[model samples]
Target: MKTALFELADQVLFQNYGKRDLALVRGEGVYLYDDQGKRYLDFTAGIAVCNLGHAHPGVTDVIERQARQLLHVSNLFLIEGQVALAEKLTQLAQRGGEAYRAMFVNTGTEANEGALKLARRYQYVNGHAEKTRVVALPNSFHGRTMGSLSVTSNPKYREGMTPLVPGFEVAETYEQAVEMLDDRTAACIVEVVQGEAGVRPVDEDLLRRLAARAKELGALLIVDEVQTGVGRTGRFFGYEHFGLSPDIITMAKGLGNGIPVGAILAKQKVADAFTPGLHGSTFGGNPFAMAVANYVVEVVRDPGFLERVRQVGEALRTVLEAHFERVTGLGLMWGFDVEDAASWRKRAAERGLLVTVCGPKRIRLVPPLILEEAHVQEFEAIVTQMSRA
Candidate 1:
């Protein structure tokens, strides 16, 4: 039966998310409870944003304490939480003890947009005003905004939004992406793993070449870690797996566990282009978000915690490989090919397992970072039950 909430939502809300049937009213650990009080084993952790799992106690405590202490404050004055969080991020993001800086925003898209701007600003400020174009990879997903969208390659996203921000283009092929880097290019943005494109891993050799070519051509390399940062890939940043150095890194999902927050961590030399008056956000680095994110990083960046993620991720990958075809991904993130993806997801949901369909025959699993081996066994049983029918 359709709930009154759906009916009321139809009357009042925008229909951007398409037709919906499930309405989760509560969450704890890796489970979600619907309005009808049915329990579900969630494999999609809010599309990779809830890495610490739903309703994490540590995040809740930070939110409560921060809310009571101080919530909103303008960027006019110094924010201690932001400073502390930045220190942790720069430390975790250390590259041979090189200095790095960060700018916080509310979403991953914003982080990308800011990073792109920083790239161009760095070039322009250095007297290379002609270097304004950006090169993005094919099948990459950045954000919904204009600046980020310009570099995003999916035609479905840019269907009618022509005349996008000037000088931004997607290379037709990964090899061409390297060739496209030149004096006119401001930066080359890429994702370590194309999570939105069915959790496909980008070509490592091509990426290394891209980074090398961009550096040779005086263009910056930006790694968009939106879906892969904060332990989603069993590492603090997905780029760590590649062993390639990037000038700027954009991340948002899983940073605050649940609270909306994003940031751009760049090498100090490149980030310094954004002077005091260049860019600013009113609510980006507020104390509340800073506190929650600080707590999340402190927990996720622990060597023991990350090692656990790597071990469990390998176990989960084994289970997926055994049960499904073309299973690909790292850490807690994974994708597999199955017939009738929509129906398969529906069956899983009906059986109290939650998954997301990313393509016609692709289903993605981005379970919480804290997922245990027992959860994998539970997931196996559910899939086994569905496969029989």
Candidate 2:
């Protein structure tokens, strides 16, 4: 069955993704079963999307119930699940401050695209129409869409996509960022941790300074939490670690545990920039996605759950450091500076362990937030054996 599927995929599917040889059929807590029922402890968690682990009963129950009830309703009509999910997100994101508003989308890229639009619209409506330029950091990965891609600094992703969107600038250093934020700068978007760029976390002081400068220059600060949000970094949102009050926060990956859901949490003041018809998504906040996301948020927002994430993350790091050198990242999002990342990843897969490579020599591990010490120990045993080999 797996071989036939592979042959069919080769003929029918687009040749964009470099997928692994394994064709997984089912999943349960921290594990996946491929065709022929070979079990592998899943460490990637579908690239950190399954925070509660694959087929989480809580999330699955809601999905099944919601699917039986109502799946989708266009934005024209009011959706109960959509409104409830948005209210919950705003409540969690407020952090004891002013009210926040949420605009749901279908993916991380869409959330970022919405954020960019929100920032530019806010500047335009406030009579700062000249503030149309956007500033982003080098080694940033925003999205693949034209709008988000414009602000993404990696040349490989943008090589053939030009002539890309204009008014996008890349700042290589804090000094460069300060100079880039002028009267013409509408927004500055950055990831709290550059996930695709090898799980690098930005310095807190630099982040605070950048936020201050953007505010002083009348530019909106947008934090892209697509990978670090929803308790992936032991925080409801990654910006919390940096003490930032950003104008816009975008998220997606783990919001629905597996369901496709993305959102932009904007301060009420900035959210007012988007009026009736400024932006809209046909399937953004549909009922089924909202239902699953609501359950996910309820689980992730718990104090005990977040604390456990911190503990588990620290343990994972400790175990990895004992086996490898130069480990980087926070919480479940970790990367190891290895000598041969690709070959190491291939061997680990062969040994029934799954991991991924980032940048050139960084092996990234963005396991599910529901990971246990036992899972980490299993991975450790594999690494220890590899070290001897």
Candidate 3:
């Protein structure tokens, strides 16, 4: 019966994801249930896409209200929610909650697509069209789209998709990245916390060095905050924790708290790169996405919200480190070394815990920001058994 349903799904939809056999029916707080009512402590949190937790009342309410009132309006027409969401997001980025323009898109990949375009066009308009090389780090996962795929450094994902956008370079070290930066480089994109790269956090000194070098070479420093922004790393923006300002920032995952929305925030001067007729999207910044994003940003940017995430993250890490030899991460986004990740994942699933595996030796724990102590303890117990096994 399960195999039939899975087969039907595969036949209808293009098989990209290795869809787990379980079918999730509903979610509340930090738990998800399958069709047969088997509950699992949801530590993966939709791969860190549900920061506010599942079925959050506030986010759901906004979606419902916006759906009833007005769902989508074309970019040609001005919408209140679009303007409001942009303002809120900008305020969340700026220190005093000041004005900064935002260009919305449908997904993180789309946001990076727009950002790359903006960076290239910005340099072109300023008489540096040759500044089109993009430098990204090894083990980086930007997005699946063509432009983003070019800078993405994973060969596994890039294997068949060859002859990708030319002028893409991969840097192994900060010094190597700096060497790749020159007058011809359009932008250098880096994830604050390398989410798909085994939850690796960039060294602080490297981040500062990259920013300074990007400024020196006239290439825009594009911070891909898709997985690390909106309080995921215990800061409004992950770069805030490192004390550096990026020329451009792109985000999506948790911006809508489960709804699809992506945005690019740039410095006013650099943002001016694109003019009226230069770029746009049909469903970008529609009412539904905007309303949801507005609510998420307000809640995530609150003073106490991220502090709670940090506190819980430290506590969880302490428990996790005791079980595993190495634990790496910033906030709730953490990964630990496991002897047999596949077996551990299977055991956790059998024991009613939902998680994700990273590489062969790592287990990732990207729970919702609102996970309680009880949930943490429960997850800790499950992981401890794996350690002894």
- lDDT tens digits, residue span 294-389, model 2: 899999999999999999999999997887777878889998888889888888887888888886788999989998899989988888888888
Candidate 3 off by > 4 Å: 1-3, 96-99
Superior by lDDT: candidate 1 or candidate 3: 1
Q: Write the per-residue lDDT of candidate 1 for residues 18-56, one digit (tens) a residue.
A: 889899999999999999999999999999989889889
Sort order, lDDT high to low: 1, 2, 3
- Candidate 3 yields a Cα-based lDDT of 0.85
On lDDT, the leading prediction is 1
Lowest lDDT block of 10, candidate 2:
171-180
**In terms of TM-score, how similar is model 1 to the real structure?**
0.99
Cα lDDT listed for each candidate: 0.92, 0.89, 0.85
Off by over 4 Å in 2: none
Clash number for candidate 2: 0
Best-to-worst ranking by TM-score: 1, 2, 3
